[model samples]
Target: MNVLLGLSASNGIGIGKAFVVPESEKRVISSKKIKAEDKPKQLERFERSLAKVTGQIASQLDAVKGDKVQSEIFETYFLMLNDPEFLGDVRKSFEASNHSIEYILNQKTEDYADRLRSSGNAYLSERAEDICDIFGRVLNDLLDFHPFDIEQVPDDAVIIAKSMAPSDTVILSKRRIAGIALTDGGVSSHVGILARNYGIPAVFDIENILDEIKTDALVIVDGTSGEVIESPDGVALSYYQNKITKAKEHADKLKVFRDKPAKSADGESFQLMANIGTVDEARVAMEEGADGIGLFRTEFLFMSEANHAMGAVHSKVAAFSEENQFNAYKRVLETMRGKPVTIRTLDAGGDKIISSLDVQHSSSEEKNPLMGLRAIRLTLANPSLLRTQLRALYRASVFGNLKIMIPLVTSVEQVEEVLAFAEKVRDELKSENIPFDENVPIGVMIETAAAAMISDCLAKVSDFFSIGTNDLTQYTIGVDRENALVAPLYDEFHLAVLRLLHKTIKAAEAEGIPVSVCGEMASRTESVMVLAGMGVRTLSMSPKLITSVKELLSKMSIDELKAISSKRLNSL
Candidate 1:
């Protein structure tokens, strides 16, 4: 068995023949400068290509009317294509350098992309891909290159590619492909977002993948674990097939609990909702019987130009006005149609910074973004930026059950400041006669040890608590999960993290406020039980994991889980 490990972009099981999607190099064939007189003609050619791409984007919007995620993808491209800075900068470069349109476009975009890539913010760096995507399509159009059509791909074939554009995923999804594996692409990429939208099994970031797997080989993709198997023997095939069967059976069984309350065997009940980044994911969560959206990652609205879905983006929101932010919240609120949606404010810093918002621009140069001013700290430091989002959320709250959450909070002072700012927005809305939710829920994310330690204080002033285990584990244990060499040291159920969780949950329960486990940890069956045992009555995770998690919750006894927790705690 040839085993390949990658990042799970989407979840599912699939077995199919590998259909390699060949990648073509995109580059300017001619770099020679045009004469002064030919500059106008070159400029005209550039405008025509831009117009064509614009038309294509408009058509996509028309085709996909209400798919906000997909619509945002095209809309960002349209924005980039028509962005005055981008267009004007490229034109200036051509005028000065007299370079070919392809050369000028490539050079200017790369220059902008380089700034973003070197911003030291991981999520912001990913926007380099967006810049490349927008300009690369225009480059291809200018060169008269006819790209491969997704419609021509074989049906039910596993798509193997080095990388995929959002459009490629969009078009190929309609072709009924079995799965997708990419040597390039992050779980936060636009294509990754589309994969989740269509429920396609996808794994990405597998290095040297094309050279490892051959075409026509039977491959088994376990998207949840990010494992892809090539030419599995009889035993392995049976194992994967049985696993698939069991998963489906499990899902079907959980369907009975769709309308049922999440009450434990001992009569302890919990709020089970979905953690989503986009509006479509909210719809999926509702279909999977989620009570409400426990975690609505509003970061996707800011990073729409980059990866575009499933929030938790530690990056910057640039050139995004109050109207832009307001419309994003309204779109999501409209989609949820009154289901409770918790919107986490910008968690910028430590690898997530909006270069534009970074007044000092010092954050983009920070060696350690994870430990730097991020989340609440970043928002507090930039009150105007915070107000921009607060106003939007406050305005959009009237459309649905909206709750605003502050992320990476470590102090009551920060919570107080945020609340004051929120109150200011509410007052302004009222004064302006703008319709808004005056009593929208205000919450704090219990991610850092400081925040978890003082949960009682935060709970006193907060309406709810969401435990962000992904960061809690990393920070409490002093391990950067992103560092490959030290990733193995990271453990979600570590004693330190468990202790923090126990304290926070108890504090929230004491205050009579709802506490939720909204991290990836809440998705696992064992972790879910442990969380419930620790007194966490609300759990939020990805939409896809809802059925399985609910299924496991339905089978387990809270009292027994508490017993296990006691035993483990005693041992620890």
Candidate 2:
């Protein structure tokens, strides 16, 4: 028996025969110079190959149109394929350097991918895979080579790969795969997100995993524990089999809470909401017995519209149009069926870069972008961006309960600025005979230390407070969580961060405004208890974690949670 431990990406147990993905044969591009007159023909060939790959990716997009994350990833391929700026650079290179199109394409794509990989942001680094995947398809088409055929992957096989791109991951999701084991993938990678969404057991960052696991070998992947056992003995295999059974049983038991309201042992009811990025997730939240959506991250809607679809490359609207935003928000609102949806207006820039936003200060220009123009700052600077979103949101508000939340709000002035802009939008809509909800609530996200510190004043202007611990932890601790060198120090449990959470909740409660946690910390079982004890009555997290959190809260009285929270706050 061989056991290997890796980062647990998804929670589940998967036992199946290993199906190691075979590496494709490396292409040998001829570096010989071509005639200058041949440039037009080479460009034509490149366009043809690009067209073919674009068609392939479109088909993939259609297959996953229901899944927002999958579709967003596939849409990025369209952006890369149709990016005039990048393609123009490639064309210039083709004209200047009389090299083969394949060589030029390979070199250019690698250069961009390398730059992104070295950007120090894990999300951007993962996007490097998308660049290579799309360009690789184009290169393959140019070379008349077919990549790994997903059709041959047998059902219930444990897929082992050095690394996986979203392209391969999307296709593999259709199968009844036992699990995924990767030597190169981060917990925040798109592949990892897809795995968790699909409820597939996945373990990533297993060093030299492909070499250790052979094809058809009996493998047990314990994603909950980040354990991989290959060729396990009967005793080990039996142990994992029992674990799998118990896990399934536990999942089945959680289903009972689907229709039950979240309440404490002492009968105090609490709001258990879901933090979602797309309309599809809203439907999932309902199915998961969520009270409402606490955080509807609007940045995703902007990200999905990157480069403005396939054929409409240079559309007049750099980001999602009012109509596009309206339809998306409307769909989510309609899906929730009158449930309160707190939609945070575009939290773009910073780590969540939306190229479509066309911010004047790009990450390349800013030395430290995380604290630079992002969220409320970006939207406030560009009134048109926030105006378009506010119009769509208010327009969609008529469909259901809507609460507008501004992100990265540092002071009451930022909230006032957004309110001022929103008023202008409302007046314009009224004059235009557009119907919208006039009483939609506007809230502020307590993500920065500045916001949390002045929550008492912010509560005077804001409708409610949503604690975004993900950013709050990093900001309060002065550490970038995405930075591997300093991520360990970015702890939500730190005394400072806990104090901020406590402060935010207390301030909101004092002002008679609801306070909720909608960050990664809310998704944690222990963190939920701490927050509930700290006087937060609402907790929003991932849809998949709702039942477990609900279950945890059901067993613990408010007093018990308060004790736990007090102990942690006083000690830690």
The estimated TM-scores of all candidates read 0.82, 0.95
Cα lDDT of all candidates, in order?
A: 0.78, 0.85
How well does candidate 1 score on lDDT at residue 199?
78
The TM-score obtained by model 1 is: 0.82
Cα lDDT tens digits for candidate 1, 1-572: 89999988898988899988877665536867678889888888888998788778767756765566677666566667666667878888788886788898888888888987776544556668888877888888989987766666787788888998766655654578778889988766777778887778899989888998887889988899999998899999999999989978877777888777777776777788888776567768777878788888766556554332112132333534678778877876777678778888887566553434334444545656678877788778877778888888888887888888899988899899888888888889889999986788899999999999999899999999999999899889988665445767989878889989989988998999988888888888778778877777778887767766766777778888787677656744
How many collisions per candidate? 6, 0
* Colliding pairs, model 1: 314-352, 316-353, 316-354, 350-369, 350-370, 351-369
Which portions of model 2 miss their true places by more than 4 Å? 304-308, 313-317, 355-367, 482-485
